[model samples]
Target: MKDLEGKTVFITGGGGGIGGGIAQAFAERGTRIVLADIDQGFAQEEASRLPRSVEVMTLPLDVRSPESWKAARVEAEARFGAVDVLCNNAGISTGFRPLFDIPPEEFERVMAINVTGVYNGIQTFGPLMAARREGHIVNTSSMNGLTPFASFAAYSASKFAVLALSDALRDELAPQGVGVSTLFPGLTRSRMSQADLGKISAGDPARRAVIEANMMEPVWLGRAVVRAVEHDEPYIITHPDYREGLRARHERILAAFGDPAQPDYHTGMTATR
Candidate 1:
């Protein structure tokens, strides 16, 4: 953890903005990077953007397929040794649509990439790291995961699942000397976000302008991820503007916690029964 130099990092969605940003950050720390994405061309593009001195491998990875994961891992291990850090960053958004309005197939695709993809990455790489008794995993969630909103129900649900998975994985890996961190990025500049904007706010130049203005540079978030990895931090909140909303959500959940509605409900000391 202290010295990232010479470590190997396998990152899903490495072709995208956030993944590229993460690759750059880790490269700066002298870590070898494997950029895995469904689009090999985009992965190559991101790889080309990295420092020439950094060791980088680009591979096509369909995170939804275990076969793809297996092939990627084979290539990665053939190039570099065992992966020291796994970044489950590949994901897709379903645009801003109400829950009932979203197509079931589209909703399923969102879950496949955003939620199940992370799970696949964990299942594929977790044991290797655990056996070694050292490694780290970074799963990218969104600010929406912490504070859900109306139109983004499906995306938010997938992100929420990522957060839960990361938390549980962290607990499970703690004893094995592995670390897990969940990244909550807010309005970062990425292809997926830009496309979502087109879908949800297509002709509204003004709305797009404001959102663009607020979009954080991907590298900045990447730097935060690197710091989190270095410190083995559990949660990485790059944008603090969402804290107030998160606070309100937490408050509501806390308010709902009350004594059991049964007179003879004596469950446990920890439970309020």
Candidate 2:
């Protein structure tokens, strides 16, 4: 995994801010890239930003569809052989709406893209990586996944699922010589984040400017992802500002653990129950 030069990397959502950043970072390492996005134009835009010497391609990919994944994989492998790194980074958000206020369809859409999309990518490409016994996977979650926030319940739930998926996949792939890493990003400047800000601020210039000022550059997050892949790290946390909040949440959960509902319930005695 440490060796990336000449390696082929396939990224979902490659047209978005974070995905584009990740592509640029991989380009810096001499890694060939396949930029797949639902919007082919965006993918091409990001691909254009990479140096001419870097081999990069853009393809329209609907992460929600297995057939799309199959086609993308076929094209990517046909162009550059087996993907050395698979990034399940395509996702959508609920725009900071309250849990109850979100429509059922919107909630479903978030889960479809944020959670199922990652699953589809893994199902499509993971087996190939296993057969090769040499590859890495990076799944993008969010800080909200670690510490759920109000007004972003559905988004948080999807991200939490990503974290769980990445952790389980990491363990499952370890024996097969494939690695998995979960990226928990915080307020990175992206079209999605910008749109969210516009919604909340009602396009208020001052508010939008303040939010923009605090946003992290996507390239920094991209570099972190590269490092994680190189070291086979399990978690790539690009933002530590939420550490205390996460610690408090975990401490509260630990405090909640207590006696079982039935005092006489023993570890092995409940098997038949």
Candidate 3:
């Protein structure tokens, strides 16, 4: 995990914005790249752009499908020894809509790709990494995963699930020497937002405004991910502004607890006074 040179990275959504950036970064480091995406053409195009010296393969993949994962794993291992890293970077957003107003299918699709898709990646690639006793897994959660966002209930819920999943997996994999890291990227300039949400008309102007405001360059996120892997960081957060929000949320949780040593809150307060 420390030295990426000549290692192989199996990346989901490699044709997409953040995924492409991640692939490019690793490829630049002389890492072998296995790029998977739902769009075959796009994946192939990205793979072709990588340096000739780097071993590259592109496969059309649907993260929602377990069969797709199995096939890709087989092909990757055959092409490059064992995968050194698995980047679960593929995701989609349901755009800005009140929970009640959102279609049921929209919620299901988002959960399938954003939440279950990540679970599939971990489940599929985890065993391979375990066998090697040396590997890294990076799951992409969003800034919304750390804090609730208005009109993005489904997307937020899925990301929150990813955050919890990554944490649990990290604990489970630690003893095995496999590294698990979760990425919380802020608004990045990616096709994920535009492609996923562009179809739905935003009923509220304020909601649309908030979405537009959070967009950042995907390359910034890519660089952060590379650094995280180098440092063996468990949690990679892209937005600095969200730190205050995370702190506030933590404070709220701490506030909810009473002194466990005290049988009665009134008595405890009276003694302190």
Query: Which one is best on lDDT?
Result: 1
Candidate order, lDDT descending:
1, 2, 3
* Whole-model Cα lDDT of every candidate shown, in order: 0.93, 0.92, 0.85
Clashes of each: 0, 0, 0
Please give the lDDT score at residue 238 for candidate 1. 94
C-alpha lDDT of candidate 3 relative to the true structure: 0.85
Candidate 2 overall lDDT versus native: 0.92
Query: lDDT by residue for model 3 over 222-244, one digit each (tens)?
Result: 77888888778999888898899
Worst 10 residues of 3 by lDDT: 264-273
Model 3: runs farther than 4 Å from truth?
196-214, 259-273
**Mind giving the per-residue lDDT tens digits that candidate 2 earns over 1-273?**
498999999999999799999999999999999999999999999988899999999999999999999999999989998899999999987887889999899999999999999999999999999998999999999998899989999999999999998988888889899999999999999999988988898948898888899999998999999999999999999988899999999999999988888987668644220
Q: Write the per-residue lDDT of candidate 1 for residues 1-273, one digit (tens) a residue.
A: 468999999999999889999999999999999999999999999999999999998999999999999999999999998999999999998788799999889999999999999999999999999999999999999999999899999999999999989998899999999999999999899999889877766889999898888889999999999999999999999999899999998999999978889977876667320
TM-score of decoy 1: 0.97
The 10-residue segment with the lowest total lDDT in model 2: 264-273
Which residue pairs collide, candidate 2?
A: none
**Global Cα RMSD, each model:** 1.8, 2.8, 5.1
